[model samples]
Target: MRLKSRLLPLAVSLPLAGTLAVALPLAAMLHAAAQPPPAGAAPEENAEEPGLAYSVSLPETGDSALDDAISRASALEQLRERAPVDAFGLVSRALAEANNMRDALRSEGYYNGSSRVTVDGAPADTPGLADRLAARGASDQPVPVVITVEKGPQYTLAPVLLRTDPPGFPLGAMGETGLAEGQPARAQPILDAQGRINQALRDAGHPFAELGRRVIADHDTRKLEVTFLVTPGPRALFARPGVTGEERTRSELLARMVQPLEGQVFSQERIEKTRQDLLSLGVFGTVRARAGDRLDEEGRLPMTFTVVERPLHAVGFGAAYETRYGPTVSAYWEHRNLFGGAERLRLEAEVNRLGTTGDTSDTGGKIGASLRTPWFLGRNQTLTFDIAALRERPDAYDRDAFTLGALLERTWSPRLSYGFGPQIEFSRVTQDGVTTDYQLLGLLGQLRWADVDNPLNPSRGTRASLLVNPIYSMGESNVFTRLRAQGSTYFDMLGDKGSILAVRGVVGSIVGASYGGVPPDKRFYSGGGGSVRGYTYQSIGPRTAINEPAGGLSLVEGSIELRQRVSGPWGLAAFVDAGSVTEDPTPDFDNVKVGAGLGLRYLTGIGPIRADIAVPLNKERGDSAFGVYIGIGQAF
Candidate 1:
């Protein structure tokens, strides 16, 4: 029923009766003949040797939008005093601008508009104008040139006409093009209507559908009548796609990826979707899709996918610094197409606390390797295997651990995804001068939804993630479930003014285990640059008899920031963060810690370079006066 209502019968007649094409040529003639050049002369380009210098004047034209459009369309205003010209040359330049101004006015629905360019109150055809300017001869004083426009009453669209090359087409196709009669007759909307009609035709299974060449505008009735000549080419179904330009990746794998799209009705949206899917494999730097100009013998449209592969291998390194945490360095080596099939293998290492106030033994490091195979089960699915060895010496605990995990990730849509897997870990941790060894087996599940505009520096939209990991400690003979959820939302407070409001919140808990029974590293701790800035790492939670940090079973954290762009590539943020760590499984606010900070952000090609300084509002005796943090992205 919906389809029947949306589309007319295939035999619907499209006609162009009672239509007159009369006004566009006259407007064109007026603009073309606004200020014709003298006999046998042409406009000259700006030369190093100055001839005549002139200033341009473009006053407000009553309508702000028209004023802006005219100003932007004026070449005289853009060239300004930098381009010197003689009297004839100036007249030529001004004359050329009349067409541009006329087009600008027509774009805003003023079909009967006109423009005039004058030099020192004299028109271009004024007698002796060239001699007068030649006499000035590059003087210091700028010659005055002015542009004026007279925009007649705005025009509305008359009943628009539709014509099909084959004489009969769907009459309902025009409903969605926003080309209804009585609307303003702006040139852009009329052009855009044609584009929309073409896309609609393509969506309706005509792969080669396009606009025809008959756009007529009549200004006699102060109305525009657009004649959209639709050419609905042969409708076709999708055929097998051919792949090319692959050096290492298996062609069979790419073909299998597109198998689901074969035999469907030809639609541009599906073609683009397949193109993006191929690019998401990560091995391809570019992917292009082309539909055959002619159908095959089976009446299906053939498709071709061409991919340009990225470098097979790459290596990179980076470093970051914070006041107390000191400098951290990291490096990675990656093989994007390892063993082909778009498999990715990466090995990375990181070292932190290069020079801190603590002993040299307090430095921490990690070494890890991961491999990801896309299309593990099918399209939009991936399988990943990871192994890592890490050491950490934070204020709450000291740890040495080795972990192994295998995950299956699936993407349900552009903004939603989920992953689940099993993990194994072996670790020796020391806390409060007591050492303990544990072997843990865990199952982890994660779900994420992100619709933000930018991953590194988002200006709008919201993103959220939830993680649930259930672990059994073989040494302790206990099982615990860890649950954490975090979300952030950004608001563009002043459009085009570069103001944003970003808010974030996190809540986490450990159940089925006591606070002391859980691994210290897995337990929640608040403070430091990433948590409650201005306080030392893990210093805001419960403390032992000697005031050393004791990790908590529950956590609650939040941050709010107002980001304002002061100028191009430079921005500032003022933020407040608050958090609490509780011994009980349920979070409590009794010991909440709050920190306030100001940050400077320098936008870069990769992301923003961030530097922030904060002071604790509820500072205790040992908290620092202020803390400084630096990194390559917005602090979560």
Candidate 2:
């Protein structure tokens, strides 16, 4: 397993004093201390500060001695959890890192010989002076620094060797020629050869084949060689992998899912995939595996699995906040083993506390449940029946809705999926405390293509979805046919400085929304948290019956984002988004709200840490909507 890095994001701007560094050389200050003494002190004598101390104060340190000072400070902090100098450990580390960078600059030929290091201090009589000077062994003495560099060492590869008899190793058909069939013994090439050799050995059934001494590089002779002495001391044969404690699932079913085939070698990829394939089933709560017990065949190993399933009858309740949904809490109860069999039944309730519901009211709630036939259409298809009621609260707008729907979903392939359903909706919307009622009936089909190489941290891939609904409604609402299409694709940057550039777009329309006018609950409105950042939610669609859109619909929206890693510990992204909702698809762009901003992401394990500020291109009077979103995972 990989260990996660524990570093925090910077929430505030760094102090201005930290941004400046003198360009000129600062040296030759031997007044007993590097800094000038405190205020109101004697004019003559060794002018020393009262709170500057150090254990190692050399009489004659060089101009760039700050490098040494930084190193010492870092080492002291790491060893004792405290820098020898009186300063926060984090501050010491930051300064030490800066000092090392300056030293490296000199080493890289940006040297200016006449440089000085000055860290001043005042009398211990000042407030909090004692606390600042709390570093052990600190005194009124000069702390030495060293800033110089010399050439780094270089070595060459020696020979290529592998302990295991990789397929066609020494040469031949090259499936595992060990060194790519007579390739040059370069430093990196040798290491690559070793890795390939290890894979080959494992492929041949020696699951425990080991590689020793990665590369042989000689300094004297500009030569290089890669060697991997695999410990393929014994021949290991394949047998059925062990599956223990799975009384719930058929042993045969579990065996079939444990992949890489029976005879394949135990590689990390295969082991991980075995876990993933099982996870996709969503049956077991936790999964774990390993290359089972070792046999006496010197370097042979077996694979084994120890799995524990979560309770079949489970109940859970959780609360989540989304810019689009506002704040919602859901409570659910699911029974995997239903009717003494393998079916599932679930019930849930959801509530919302913000955003307009076409009526611009401010309080809403939803409760719904689904009874699913898990074995529908032979395990791959899902047959679901559900009923729900929703009460929405938009700023100055509000609506309440009741829905009854049924859906059939199927996953035909890894890359293709579809869902078809029919729904009936009844709602009452309130705007500025005024309420109205509406009704809607519709049938819809949805298709999706979501095959990204990495679903969790996808850098490149395409995902597109289409939604269609033909419905009829009345009572202060429009009865119309709806069509919606949206897609997003990403591509990684080319060359060495690789990153990802992604593009996304959405377009929805009211096909025949001509009669009865759009109801307060049926018409789409735009602006707010989720739609165009810097705006509100659902505020992007069509206008309301009042001639002004409480939540605009009927518009085309799109955006392009360019992302890159600006530093080892940081990520940078820039994006521009623009869109608007009018009577038609060809709305004037001049009236569209366009926003742009930059975001910074620190690779936090919780997910990508993000902070973005979007400014509208066409800022209108009293248009003061700017979005701020923070959470785990990517915005998508």
Candidate 3:
């Protein structure tokens, strides 16, 4: 009986003991791999680890991982200095990292080795006693570390293919996009945009689109061929039972928003766009759209919108803090539908506290809104009109101004828009009363070209815009006239790598000098984030005889930037800028105030959050000490 009792317990206990016993060696191995060497001992540096805590030293001391957290692109010099704990699986992971890195750099058109490690001081072989000791106490030796980098293989876009389902697909709409044939198709954004095109086609009532792609490579030629295969199912129809969320949108508007065609091919684009259009009303809490063959035969997809309307149209407020602009707050009231039918109207008040001017006129603001008709002329067009009023006083001009204006806008297509109207202007004297008071009639024209399917971060494509405004005064001593032109361009340097380059230019002047005076507000003022980065608003314009840079008429401004993607929806940029304001129509180019700066971007829902600090190469009296800008979207 005693022997039996002992054996039973021993059997159970022995298994437990074995488990713990075996675990110790395994634990030891892992511990030794990641354990750091103690101070004051020569040791062999081991490979790097992903989770291992590390310290990096760059060519420039400011380079560090913490800096990378807020940066758009990572710095290679800084990346080279990271030191990971020496441990198990370290060498193997390092060896197998090639594929992982290839994927990461492929987006940037640089599909090369993303990392390189070197031991500059760690001896290839430690001294006899040190080696023996390190094997036992790897934690007790402090090892010297050094590394170098070799940037590797680069690839370019090779081709794209188009695939269709059901074997026989209609290619009429494609109309020589050339995408059907293989072309040098580089950049993920472009690829994504192509996806959007497919989606748009589907949305256009072609619901049968099947989006797929294939890649072919030629090793000898170092070329890649990519083909997109599309399978478009049978045409679908709008056989609706009823519409939900009618309370959120007027029944009439909701009805207009619905396009149920019989025998029309279903498209993913149309479904999503209808959803977006619904949300654009700003009346809904949430809007969802789905289209598939779930409700029909022959894979016929029907469009349905599930919507959640806002509970209330009441007051809402928001506030934000930034390094450059201390704090800002804005409040607004909106009605999702003023008189029903998904029409929208909103009113807002705002205040801002800037670092230099405290809370002055620049901080105070007001706005008004109205309805936007999506199909003013046709499905591809839209029309909108708004009226707004504002009052404010700023420190720079020691001025306060109040005015009301009305504007009417029309969009011929999604890519093109234009607007014009009239304004009654009046202002309190502040800057020598050089030009003030007028009933102004303004003419405005605008044009834009943007191919990116996504608005938040356009990976690949180009966007260009131009705006011209000419204002003429009706009642005045002398008939005053002003002409202004602004142009901007967005380019994806390499597209999918999250890299971008942007440029903008502005030129304005008083044309056909009028006997009537021009309002100070109507006159062009430079500086701040939009004009000169390092100067305050109105402090960067044409200089007077005393070399002052506050007042002027004709002005020229421009900026260029190179953006790089870092990690996880972040980016970094380096830029150069130049501009000048001239009293005369023709200003001296060499005499302009030029500056350069770096910027950081966070891709947010609304747009990219931008922060930039600029320093001017040429500085004069009353110039800004340093330029700090915080805002949404690009400065241009």
Candidate 4:
């Protein structure tokens, strides 16, 4: 009889004629292979017998592709805590594993493959195998299982056909659906082609598309043919959208956030986008958007948004430590839905430099409150208000200030946003024992673009931002403008294994003012964990006679990092950072500083926890030999 075109569902096990010539007891073989027990135990006669153990071996097949497929599908390779306790259990498992190997070969395009399982010079299906195992006494020996496979010629695909009722759709334009003549005949590609056809129809405004498939195999030619029948249903438009699971939140507000207009063409893309928008509000724990099963009387598809609200109130606290700044602590309390329109209010406080050996006056703290309103006046827009009081003393200056500001931000797309705002500040500044009070009015504008693959741990993409702030000192005759731009790009060297190369650059300048006229806090300074790493904060700029820092008007910085994932939950990084601060408005590359470091990362659910140790490449007097920093997230 000839083999049929259909798959072989049952595994075949038969005894080999000459393989069992040496018939030795199973316990004797196990004893010779077992290792001695730990020391200081009772004598062998008095001790309890050790449990049975087993090991599996798969020899190379001379064909790399076939060997890899067998390794991936081999049940014996994936077993961890599933080892059998007795000889009978071991023989039963061996018989089942033979079937698993045969199925694995079929998935890889090999339809005529064969597998054999053997245990200690005998086939797994030997009659009276259980009786033979019972004859051996209890022994602390390990059993050996060997699996061998012979993968036949792979089958290729034959002519492929797709039929639709309309007969005018260009199916070829759907891009590589993975089904093509002369390619390998695999089950995955055939299923993928069916999905692609259905999605193409739906994307083209056919909301109710369906697909059916048929496959035929020819054993003589070793070829497979596939066909798909597509049903392109009638076109449909979106109907009025409804919201569910609303308690404290107003339905009208959520409707505005959804923004699905009636009579628009139905689109799966739009439905998914609406779901993401609702989740971004931070007020919902879950959001789902789906279309009605059938078209309405008017040929319109009704849409529904179901959501689960998050807790209205929350409180969080965090802390970090650095060699230069001691320990810093922060806390915040928030009301996610202060009013009915997805408004948020948060109050926060922070204190830094708790146990540092620097000047006692160089400690700092702040208290602030902020409010944010989503969907302000238009879609993808937000309005924010902030008020704060801060006191900080650094190497260059001391500041006591109060600030109030309002900003209006608009998100043009998923990757771009722009904002403009007005701020007022009243500050008391002290430098070199001289105290001066000033009131300032400023207008700030900012633009940002980011298309990173991930927000917490990105391996590829780019991020950039620009800010321009013009300020007028009401107490002094000083007017200056601060312009800054920074950008970073990430590249993945090894896909998904977390090997990445990241580069960043920053440049800034102060126009319309001399070095002496710029506010100490407003001027630029670089060197710290957030900057040049190895040096202390504000230590790279000009200095007084006593070696205290004097802030500068121009700044330029750049950094490069090579990150590699070591193992699960662990990673390693090597980096180099360089920057300069100049007194002139335009950077002259004077007094530049360079720092290099190595870091360790432990990945977590929220983000990566980082620890870095750095040394100054161009160390000056009074600079620390090295610095250590511990924090959350990437350095950028």
Best model number under lDDT: 1
Candidate 2 structure quality by residue, lDDT tens digits, 1-636? 111111122112112122322211112111112232233222221224332333321222333443433333222223222223233321242233333333332222222222222223332123553344445344455433322232122223344544434543432211363444333332233334556766666665556555554332233343333444455534465445676666466565566666344665455666666676555544567778766557635344667777766577788775545454456566888876454333467877766664435443555677777777643654356778888877766553666678899889887766878889898887777753456676777888899889665664458888889988778775534457667788888787773434888787877766565422555555444554334666555555443455334543365777887878888858887888777776652334545777777777777644576666566667554454465554344544
Better of 1 and 2 by lDDT: 1
The residue-by-residue lDDT of candidate 3 on 144-216, one tens digit each, is 2322223333334465545566566666544333343333323344455455756555555655545554443
User: What TM-score would each prediction reach against the true structure?
Assistant: 0.90, 0.57, 0.58, 0.86
| Residues 496-561, model 1: lDDT tens digits | 639989999999999999887898889988887767777777888888666788888999999999
Off by over 4 Å in 1: 1-42, 46-48, 173-175, 213-220
Q: Rank the candidates by TM-score, best first.
A: 1, 4, 3, 2
Q: Can you tell me which runs of candidate 4 are displaced by over 4 Å?
A: 1-52, 62-65, 83-85, 137-141, 165-176, 357-360, 588-590
Global CA lDDT computed for model 1: 0.80
Error of 4 at 212 (Å): 3.3
**What count of clashes does model 3 give?**
35
* Residue 461, candidate 4: C-alpha displacement in angstroms: 2.4
Off by over 4 Å in 3: 1-242, 260-273, 291-302, 314-329, 352-389, 395-402, 433-436, 443-445, 448-460, 477-481, 491-498, 514-516, 543-550, 564-571, 585-590, 600-609
Deviation of model 3 at 163, angstroms: 14
Residue 187 in model 1: lDDT: 62
Error of 3 at 458 (Å): 5.0
For every candidate in turn, the CA RMSD to the true structure comes to: 6.1, 13.8, 14.4, 8.5
| Pairs that clash in candidate 1 | none
